[model samples]
Target: MSIPILSILVFLPLAGCLLLLPAWNCRRLARPIALVVALTELTLALWLYASWKGLAVNPFPQGFLLLEDAPWIPAFGIRYTLALDGISLLMIMLTAIVFCVGLAVSWDSIKERTSLFLSMMLVMEAGIMGVFLALDLALFYLFWEMMLIPMFFLIGIWGHGRRLYSTLKFFLFTMSGSLLMLLAIIALHLLYAQQTGVSSFQLQELLKVQLPLETQLWLYAAFFLAFAIKFPLFPLHTWLPDAHTDAPTAGSVILAGLLLKTGSYALIRFGYPLFPQAAQMMTPLFYSLALIGIFYASLVAFAQQDMKRLIAYSSIGHMGYVAIGIAAWQPVALSGAIIQMANHGVTTAALFCMVGMLDERAHTREIAAFGGLWGKLPLWSFFFLLFAVTAMGVPGLNNFVGEFLILAGTIKSSPLVAVLAFCGIVFPLIYMVRLVQEVVFQKERQPLSLNDLNPREIGILAILALLDIWMGIHPAPLLEMLHVPVQLLTGGTP
Candidate 1:
């Protein structure tokens, strides 16, 4: 039998979490140990990607690669199952990279309770990996809920002013949606049992059990609500800015990079495929909501004085494009949406890391407080500008490719949505340029001595910058990986 490599990848960080307990008293060793563990996980992800690329057979249409299915509950048909496809592979890679970068960024900032912080980070990584790998609905739900604990602790214990409020709000919003999803899962399970005379939560098995359109609509809403809350679509987005503003730098990176993508991933993996008719019927509503979110969040971001808050709002707008592309339900649009997930993860995480660096030095996240930083911290300003241009969807940057494909695909379906999304792009330019102008070009507001980014920080930003450029110029590899899977999902030709 082949090794259960997928399980190893999913739980390696949990192993790291356990290993971290013994080193709890040694503050100096905590971060180094965590970094090593994160890098190991990243290495495993890269290997998985390489192995997948070399495979002669396409594993996605057959359901997944490195698939593992073993009976766990004989009576109810629940199983210990995990697998990966192009989508899961890319998301796993992003999680590993972001966690490593997040840990590196926290090296100097987290001075107290170092062990607990690193342990929580590892646990969060484990949970995210599990979410990406799980193929059974019950298993997926377990991993989905597992992510909450570590993130709650990270934000509530290690965050800034109003952390408690932000933590509670974030928890309540996500948990409430999760409960509705749980109900829907149980309902689906029971319905499947009634129809097939067997109980199961296996996604592939469940996909074969078709429900009536009315039933699909109700079930889809339950799933969509859960994902939308996590996606934080439009009005449900209230919890996001607060969470991003108050959470620690590492927490913000994880939230922006990995957590937000899970919502879109779930929609693609489960919500749409499991309820195709309902998904088609609901497309217009989702497109409308996404457009509104883009316009609304971008407008709000322009008015923000706090740097983190501005970026927080900007994330909502960026994700709105992902939502639009997914709702379009075209293979090209879905491919764009998936690639955009990675692009947004890399670009936004870098932005948050840069803001964290600025905050660490200046002790403030206020835009007005940080003027003429280019004069004092040229390297820092340069990195910030790079990511800012990427965020603006500037040509020859990562964002431009994804946004262009999304617009192209969207226009084929709904020219109006394409037009509206195009208008939304302008808002990012307004706020992003405003951000660059006030922070980099305008005169310094206060007389304060500031240091530029350190070697470690520069390395992290440089890696992300290179990835942005590579994806912008030649996204063929990313698009190629997802081509079969996206075509399969959308029932379209590559």
Candidate 2:
């Protein structure tokens, strides 16, 4: 029998979380234990990457490359089913990478309740992993909500000023969405049971039950509301900046690097695929919101004085490209969207780390407080510049390729939207360039000592920077994993 790789990947972190509970007194062990588990997860993810050749010529009966199915609740058709495809695999890998970075960055920053902080992070990791891999709707919802508890604490307990306010806002917004999605899930399951005369919450089985356009519209709206709130698309994105500004560095990293991606991933994995007609009907609205998000977030980012908050807004803008790509619903655009998710995760996470490091040394995140850092912190300045420019979608960087492909694919669908998006790209460059000047190169506003990047900080940023360069130059491998799945979705070559 094949190894239950998916189960091991999902539950391993939870196992680590349990292990940490007993070590609450031995707080010193928390970091190493968390680091070991995170590293192990990353190793497993890389192993999968290395061994992956392509999808099988014959797809699995359940439509996943790797799947595990067992009855968990026979009466309700809820099952302990975990399934993985190319997209899930990518998400899992990204989760592993970002989580590893999160742990590394938190090594020294988290002082009080060390064991608890690490434990929450581990729990959240498991939840995210389950969300990516679970094929059972019930299981997926369980994991989706499971992630929230840890994040809520991460922001509320370990966070900074106004942490309680941000935490409350985050909870209210997310809970409202989760309840809607739960209703939709329950209704969808019942609908399936009524049609097939067998209750089931397996995504594959659910996909087989056809619904009228009206039903699809309602269900899709429920699902979309949940995702869009999480996606925090445009007008719904207000909570993100506050959350990022208040939460600890690790929280911000995971929030930007992985949590946000889940929203778009679900749209691709479950939302549009489950309700194709509704997705088509909603395309124009998504496109308009995406464009508006890109432009609006860029302007707000440009105006921000807090470095962390600025990067937080930049995340919303970068994600707008993903939304637009999904809205376009073409092969190339979808591929770009997926790639953009990973690239944005790496870049934005690194930018947050930079801000955190600066805050650690200087005790502030205000942009006006930093100036002429190039002379004082050359290493830090260089990395900050690289990631900032990458975020700007400069040519020969990670963001550039994704943005280019998105524009290329989007133009084929709607020339006017493409033109507007193309213009939106310039906004990032404008704000980012201005930010670089102010933070790294402009005249010193006050006399203060700032240190260069240390080995640990350098290592984190270096890994992310290499990824930005590597993905920008040779994105073929990522695009390869994406090709078959995206082809299935778009029915065209990616």
Candidate 3:
């Protein structure tokens, strides 16, 4: 029998993480090893993507690659089921890309305890992979928590001032919500046991779970609380700005790039199917929050001088489209959401990387200090402009396609939302254009004689730029990969 590719993907990182134990004395080798591991994972993910032509279609089963499953803890009826349908596959690809970017961004910059820092990043990749592939809810939660530990240490150990406070805040906030989800999961397990007299954690089995309306509503609320807090929708978003501001460059990159997306991913993957009826009932509430987040976060982003905080706020705004797409329930819309999530992962990671480069050189994130950079650091300005434009949902880029699908989908749901969300797009144009004007286009105001992108920086940004442009002109493959899972969720004719 062939070895399970998905299992290999998950364990390879843990293998890399474990290697740190014996070689703790040599800190210099750790970053290189981690970079190698990240590259290896990317190769594997690209292999998978190529197998599927990196395309997703409606009715997503055909797009899934390297699916594997088996029995584990059979007495309690649990299984180690894993699959890579469109959604999972995209996330896996995104994980690999961002992991590579994070490693490259941190190269030659992170000094203290370099070995331990890379170890945490390895663990983080492992955890995120598990979250994307695990088919069993019990297994999913384990992956979910697995991601938290490495992140805590990353923020707490390598983070800036108030690192401890920021890490704790991030931990407590997520924990508070996830705890409620745990209760809900237990409730689901017991209910399933009561209904079928089998204590199973199989996803296919649980899909058949029929519960009272009131019960579904309550359970949905519990799960939503967990996903929402992480999504940091509207009111619950307070933790994100602080966490991003204080976290090290790599921490901010991974946090913005992968950690927060898990919340939105859970909503699309589990929240809806687990409670479709409840989802239908709560559409209005979800839409309202999405709109508020889109407009409000943009305003907050506009007012920020701290580059990381501005990007962090923009993350919340971009995610508003994810929520909007989910609520829209149109096939076009769902595809948009998935694409946007991937686009956000790439573009935002690139932007945060720029922030890292800036902070590393200038010793501060204040935008005013950056002027007349176009000549002094033309390459850096070019890449930053590219990423900033993509983030603003510019035409002929990845974000534009997703944003269009979202608006087109939202119109079908609520024309008011379609109109309101467009307004949100304008907000980004204001700040993003201004970012270009002041930071790059303005006359040379400072003679600090900044440098352009180094080889590593250009390499990562090149990958991102290629993807952004690729998605803009040729998004068909992506749309194909995502079709089936979405159709499955909607129960609509494909």
Q: What lDDT is obtained when candidate 3 is compared to the true structure?
A: 0.86
In angstroms, give how far residue 462 of model 3 lies from its true place: 1.4
Q: What is the C-alpha lDDT of each candidate?
A: 0.91, 0.91, 0.86
RMSD of each: 1.1, 1.3, 2.1
TM-scores for candidates 1 onward, in order: 0.98, 0.98, 0.96
A best-first ranking of the candidates according to their lDDT comes to 1, 2, 3
Residue-level lDDT tens digits of model 2 in 1-494: 27988899999999998888778867688899999999999999888777666444455753457778899999998999987777888889999999999999988998899999999999999999999998888999999999889999999999999999999999999999999999999999999999989999988899998899999999999999899988879899999999999999999999999999989998888898889999999999999999999999999999999989999998999999999999999998998999999999899999999999999999999989989999999999999999988998888899999999999999998999999999998888888898899988999999888778889989999999999999999999999888878988775542
Clash count, one per candidate: 0, 0, 13
TM-score attained by model 1: 0.98
| Model 2 misplacement above 4 A | 54-59, 492-494
Residue pairs of candidate 2 with colliding backbone atoms:
none
How much is the lDDT of residue 148 in candidate 2? 86
Question: Can you give the lDDT of residue 385 in candidate 2?
Answer: 91
Tens digit per residue, CA lDDT, model 3, 1-494: 16688898888999997877766767677777888899999999888778774333322353345568788888878788777887888899999999999998898888888888888899889999999998889888889999989999998888897888999999999999889998998888889999999998877778789988899999999999899988879888889999999999989889988988899899888888888889889989999999999899999998988888899999999999888998887788888988998988888888999989988888888778878887788888888888998998888999999999989988986899889888889988988888778888887666675567888888888988899899888999888878777776677654
Q: Can you give the lDDT of residue 181 in candidate 3?
A: 90
Q: Which stretches of candidate 3 lie over 4 Å from their true place?
A: 53-66, 444-446
